[model samples]
Target chain A: MEERQRVRRPGGRAARVGAAVHQAVTDLISERGYGKFTVGDVAARAGVADSSVYRRWGNLEALLTDVALTRLNARSPMPDTGSLAGDLHTYAANVAREITGPEGLALLRLAVALSGNGQQGRRALDDLLAERARHLQSMLDRAGERGERAPDALEVLDHVMAPMYIRVLFGLDPLTPEYVDGLVDRLL
Target chain B: MEERQRVRRPGGRAARVGAAVHQAVTDLISERGYGKFTVGDVAARAGVADSSVYRRWGNLEALLTDVALTRLNARSPMPDTGSLAGDLHTYAANVAREITGPEGLALLRLAVALSGNGQQGRRALDDLLAERARHLQSMLDRAGERGERAPDALEVLDHVMAPMYIRVLFGLDPLTPEYVDGLVDRLL
Candidate 1:
């Protein structure tokens, strides 16, 4: 109650601090994987006092979950790239790039680690996947309207998206433009 | 170094202890998710001292990775079900079963958590996925031998296996036997 009132009081400074902290979380995750970070690390990176983070999000996993939500929001409402394939290719590329990158890789690790814990982490993961599915489905629907080919949204996600993730997450194969293109062609 | 010497000097007590520790790891991971576990928990569960686990595996992550390797070994080398569809159905069932089960889910979460930290955990995950791909490839090869249709190993993984995992992991859909059959029919 007190925290909510403080944020709503004025200037939106609390909001800015929240944003900075989240951004710092992203940068840190991107730079190093999630295993090595601490709340103090996040606080120092965000230029906020350690107590400010404790006062706000209360803990590391919660803060990280909040950060993941923001990242999801920033990435979502998938762009209309004309065709489902185009949207998928664009979308997959973004995901591929993020996971393969140092920061994104860290964030993904944290997500997996979180998956083993409580409902909050698992829900975040499920929601993230479902949200992407919704956006991807919109593009497929658009493709159908255009009289182009379209598969079930889930089918495309499973066939294309799952393998892409398996490969990227495991380093089983290079997540290349060629690989993404191939996934698009085969699925479509 | 001393521990290795101690194991070598024994009447295979080391082997028994090792197996017990690994089993305890699996049981705990299955009962709860990996997040709630520690070397101490594993030690107690195994009826071994914490120092035993510490001396053998050195850290929680290392122990977890070793446990993952064992699970992968136990799960792989799927039977020759005479058709790619049959083989995949059998194989995917094993995976779906594991992921849905507490043990498998915990292992997966661990793999994802490790994905960001070091190459060791990531490599274990990669090897596990690749091992499954190889077994799936054997079925594809057999299909080719019979002049039956076959896709590339990676494609098979992406289309057949990927969709199965996406559903099982995300709960986007049910992982019924009928569902696996449907996935096989579509991909094949």
Candidate 2:
């Protein structure tokens, strides 16, 4: 499902170059987890010059941060199923499906790793996490529009997201619909 | 903080060799992260014969699994304050401390990566995750003793644990005591 959806496009020749490089970044990341790719590898794979890649993004870490930030901006279509709980369940199920797959888990594990990098890397990761949090907040706000009370919304968000991630990244259990429903029911 | 405490002692002769090799495993894992260590490295670092290390653990994955399981057995001292929420609160704070540190995060990331391994590798990680779940369940059971009603405790457990791990592993935010206090208060 995720494979069919490419990174959302930006305009112009520079955007074309950016899209090409980002595509190479995603492919290499999925093919070989984090810590294995280099700027030269991304350049060669994207058919862009190594100098162009380096001139554009400084180093491998910067390129990864750029790709991650760009990917966040092209965010996946979020669930909006009337109630906050319903939306979160849909979101959890989607997360479970993604994490259990190689590509999704690889990107996430890579995110966790990059989150630990020094300064600029940390800021990039912060933006990425905040992007996800915003989706949760929006879902709850929609619930509020429907007249449901969702005070302490952030804590509720934690209950919804944390478990799905733990399952996806840890493989403790199958992310069955039953499990996600149980979580949504309990938290709500 | 973790550097101050080694995996607790198990027993004699074979135990001595096991301790040395496990120590080597921890050090190499911290320094190089995953997929970068070898049996030969462990053997040389632990001053054991390479043949001995191979005979006992067979391969790197198996060795990692063994080391991780042994570390699990020497689990952290459980938080046992009178109230269920109080104990969970303490537990969450301790978890925040452990996970934010380099050594703890390295081991956990390694576990997540290894959980994707085939058969024996998966089983080892499964056992490791189950062991932690058992600790949480035990805490809930004790809460039951105090007559605190936590229906569907596994989901409740997720509410308790998921956010902390997500924050620590993803660097989403600081795992402050106040943050943990919020989780406990919201859930209980």
Candidate 3:
């Protein structure tokens, strides 16, 4: 489904270049792991000059962060389903699908690796999570205003949204739609 | 509170050695990041032979994993407040306190750096999260049995437990007790 969506999305030259670079990085990370791969390898795979890659991203971590952010942004936004349960189910399913997918897992694996180092890596991960959380929070707030969710909409955001990443990134059990639905029904 | 609890748990020579080595690695990683640190540094700091560190944990990643897991286990268990809201509030507060603390942030930063690289690093992180989640799940299950929580306990776990980590790890707003209480009231 995500593959189909990516295929359908319009891509311009810069977007294409970004996509190519990001894909190259992803392929390398998935195949060789982070420690073994280098910016030079990324440059070669993307068919771009090392200088260009460095000029755009400054470092390997920054380049990976850009790729992660781009991939994260490409995910489907939360939907309004009238009821809290309905909205939560939609949100959970979307998250479950993404996290369970190859790209999401790859990013998660990358994030966990990068999270342990310095402030730059930490900030990059924090920014990615915050972006997603803010989006989910906005949708949740709408649900609250419409009387589909509780006054404290962030509760659903925390409980419903955070676990998918935890499970997927940590390589725990696969997050199924049923598991998400059950969570939404009880929590919301 | 964690300081008090650490004093209570006593162990043998191997456990002591592991603790020493773990602390050494953590300190090194905190100061120098994983990319620049090595087994020799960990050994020298721990006052153990270099081969001993390698024999016990294989690589720096494995050594760090042991350190993280041991430190995590040393924290106080969640209090059973007999209400889902109360339990969640306490849990969130505890998590908030940990994540905001110097050591917690340091570990999180380290995990991010290590997560980008190897399968071992990823698994190590997953183990850490799973250990914590299991603890939360046990508490939630107890709440459910007491009729203080929803029938579907995992929902409460996701909504209540997951978000606390999200906010702290991302370094967003401080996760206050009031926020946790609000979340619990709405979701539980």
Candidate 4:
């Protein structure tokens, strides 16, 4: 079995500083956007020294990426249901709630804007997406192993999850619980 | 019956000028990025007056948005193979090809980056997404009408299409035609 790597959660002074800096960065991005916000603004907003912000995150892109990841991790985990359909419904609802939330939408908008610029920005966006995909894949894998789903379950799982992001990211429509349930029924 | 929208094909001096300006903007965004590129730079690159560029597009955001939309429309239309499986395979393959292609990847990277910023930028990103979704939805809707798909065909379509975009946009993994086939088989 491949061992899952553990990520370090912020702790001690680093945690406190990270929390403050992240909150500041989020506020700045929401207020002025990535185009207008700067490391100096983040430092001023957080009431920390400029060097302190730079020492921790290295650059504006790195700082915002970290903040986005930290906020994501703080959210509730995907629920475990005996059935794949039940689990998917719960998962989709959770995702819909998060994506539609104020902070989530703001951060998402920022990531989308920054994703096309530089190598660092691209990697940051890719990393966040990979993390989420892995989580969804793991859940589907477990369902398959339990004989609750077919051997090639990722395809079905992807079909279910993809539309939610499409609806939200594309602004074509809203992702509602009804939509999620409809997807779960057809897919699983 | 709803009237079908005709695809605009650029011709004549004014149309050619617009195309040239759009190409320049795309090149600039790919090379220098949206954040760094300006209307003046685009006009200079296209060999057009700055006022001309502004007159054509109200602002830089509007210009880039229109350019992105035009490029997307110019791509070959999705094939109609009369079979959902075959059509999906073609569609997914096309998406994978574009997402992995040099220009496609560049544009995708740009779209992702800009997704999170100012209202104008966010709306632009949304419009690009809606065009693609509408394309997919139309295909799926046709299948449903023909009694060749499930009652909830859109959900089925979403399941198949979403993963490919998720993989490409998020850089989770490369999408293969085989995977697309598998998705179609399972979903259908």
Candidate that scores best on TM-score? 1
All candidates' chain B TM-scores are 0.83, 0.85, 0.77, 0.78
lDDT (C-alpha) at residue A55 in model 3: 69
Clashing pairs in 2: none
Scored against the true structure, residue A141 in model 3 reaches a CA lDDT of 77
TM-score of chain A of each: 0.81, 0.81, 0.82, 0.81
Ranked by lDDT from best down, the candidates are 2, 1, 3, 4
Interface RMSD of candidate 2, in Å, is: 2.4
Best lDDT goes to which candidate?
A: 2
Model 2 chain B worst lDDT run, 10 consecutive residues: B1-10
Per-candidate interface DockQ score? 0.50, 0.43, 0.31, 0.33
- Residues A88-145 of candidate 1 have per-residue lDDT tens digits of 7787677677667665555655555555547887787777767777777878889899
lDDT of 4 by residue, B31-93 (tens): 775567788999999999999888767888778777777776666377788876677778767
- Candidate 2 segments whose C-alpha is farther than 4 A from its true place: A1-32, A35-60, A78-100, A134-148, B1-17, B35-56, B77-94, B118-120, B138-153
Model 4 agreement with the true structure over A50-116: per-residue lDDT tens digits: 9988876788878877877767655637677976777777887887787775577667656665566
- Give TM-scores for every candidate, taking all chains together and pairing residue i with residue i: 0.85, 0.72, 0.73, 0.77
Measured by TM-score, how close is model 3 to the native structure? 0.73
Task: Write the residue-wise lDDT of candidate 3 on A1-188 in tens digits.
Answer: 35634655467555666677899998887676555678899989998888878866789988887777777777758788777667668877887887676666776667655565477777877787778767777776787688663634455556666777655644556787677776676564
lDDT of 3 by residue, B41-93 (tens): 88999999999888767787777777766766666477788776677777667
Worst 10 residues of 3 chain A by lDDT: A148-157
Q: After superposition, how far is residue B15 of candidate 4 from its true place, in Å?
A: 3.7
